[model samples]
Target: MKVDRVLLIAGGRSGEHEVSLSSAAGVLEALPYDADVAVIAKDGSWLLGPDALDAIDAGEAASGGHPFPPPVAWGDYDVAFPLLHGRWGEDGTIQGFFEMLGLPYVGAGVTASAVCMDKDLSKRVLQQAGLPVVPWEVVRKGEPAFVGLEPPFFVKPANAGSSVGIARVERYAELQKALEEAFRYDEKVVVEQAVSEARELEVALLGNVRAEASVVGEIRYDAEFYDYETKYTAGAAELVIPAALDPGTQETVQEMAVRAYRLLGVRGMARVDFFMSGEGELYLNELNTIPGFTPFSMYPRLWQASGLTYPELLSRLVELALE
Candidate 1:
């Protein structure tokens, strides 16, 4: 299918609003087509027009004086590219909205978005499929308890991404504070046992029906952990494509990534994260349906390493959506 008019949606009411705008910028610069960008304000208003991209480029709202339309009116474009991350965007809300509008958008569908956004549910599904995941316990508001898990675990919001609200609790006494921090982002929190000598690795998956995994990439950071700041802040982390792993290990990571992608029913694109322990054990961490599109992000960089340039990568994703 030949895609002409493209509606690029970005920004949202989530904590990753600024980051989403940055992702939209990269998508805008790399798109092969003249895409009409739309910005979803923090209040959930859709700001769009020919000048929407210009307003987003200046980090300003396009709704100040422009006429904003509802999501149902997005049928003007042949395809839509939603770069909105976090709650309202990546969590299946916007995907369902697009589906209701009879609009085909890039990336996973409603089911995939919802299942992957919720860490607890995704973990259960992945584990049931015989995939190895980091051992963890779920904590609710007043029902917090660690049955068999030990301390020195990482506490994170079950529905957030990019390490928005994550904490490393080394002692039992720190559990409450960590849970509080995590609860700020989500109702359910996951406390995972820290992987010893763990190495952060990621793989980018693309396509529908039969998805393909890109070469694995490793993340190296000097921060205590890969927190939100370390992920977005310049120089806080370095991504090594082809991940310095042995050929066998690299192939294993890629294979498992593809398996998880297909099992999760992810259609267009996804970034699968893994944790490799010092003993060579690999654990499926989580999946990001609409990963960051910035130049430095691991998703595009992995595809670029696999011989797909950023612009070509964006084009392929749009084509996949149309397919």
Candidate 2:
């Protein structure tokens, strides 16, 4: 069956714009349609059709030399496959736009995106849901933030992703700098106790009600933490799929991953990250509503290794979104 419309929106004002574009590039190639890609540049611009990439390089929202295109009508496409990550795209802003336009875009809805984008709220919901999220405190703007929270905790923007403005403060002396950095991204900041000697594990959750968990994967970053550089730049870190763990522990991780997905009301797909301590205890990490889509990305790779081909995975997401 041919899909009438599938706009793969990528690039955004957020720090993860490049990652989003990389993801959109992959989705553009895999979508059923041969020529239906929309490049949403970082500067609040839109580039449609074949020359989207060139338009991106031209540093404008639209391709020059063409008449200004009016705002796209909602009915233009059956589905909008948004590849936007962080800031204006993922924080319910674009999702709200899609809702106003009566568009059925892929990924979590507005409420889910809003809650997930705000780390403090996400943790609170998880805590209320009887999930094991690290203890955290919210430091809103214009307040003394250095006090109250324990030292050696993670300082991150309240509503940011891709580890943007994230700081791993190992001491009291580092708390202020970390808070400043995190506050730069957003008015609010989240400070949580660092889980030392914990292994980073990630599980891909797919679907809505009948969510399925992919084989657990682990991230091994050589840096002090899995910051932005360690996530995108080559040689920054290594990813281990089907992370080696005892059968019982593996089942526990899988269960936690699914539970987190359900509690967040996440739909379509999410990458649930966890911090497995040296004693085998697992702590819930944040969820990625719009994860990377590169061919080598873990989201697709996890499914591929679990018997789902790349095209099949891509098709599954679109199908799930439409449903």
| lDDT top scorer | 1
RMSD of each: 2.0, 2.5
Candidate 1 local lDDT, 1-323, one digit each (tens): 66768988887778888888898888888799878877877666766675567657876453433333554356668899998888988989988878977888899999999999999999999999999999988888778466367877899899988788899988888888888888899989888999999999999998998988999999999998999888878888998888899899989998898899999999999999999999999999999999999977899999999999999999999999888
TM-score of each: 0.95, 0.92
Q: Among all windows of ten consecutive residues in candidate 1, which has the lowest summed lDDT?
A: 62-71
Error of 2 at 58 (Å): 8.3
Candidate maximizing TM-score? 1
Candidate 2's TM-score? 0.92
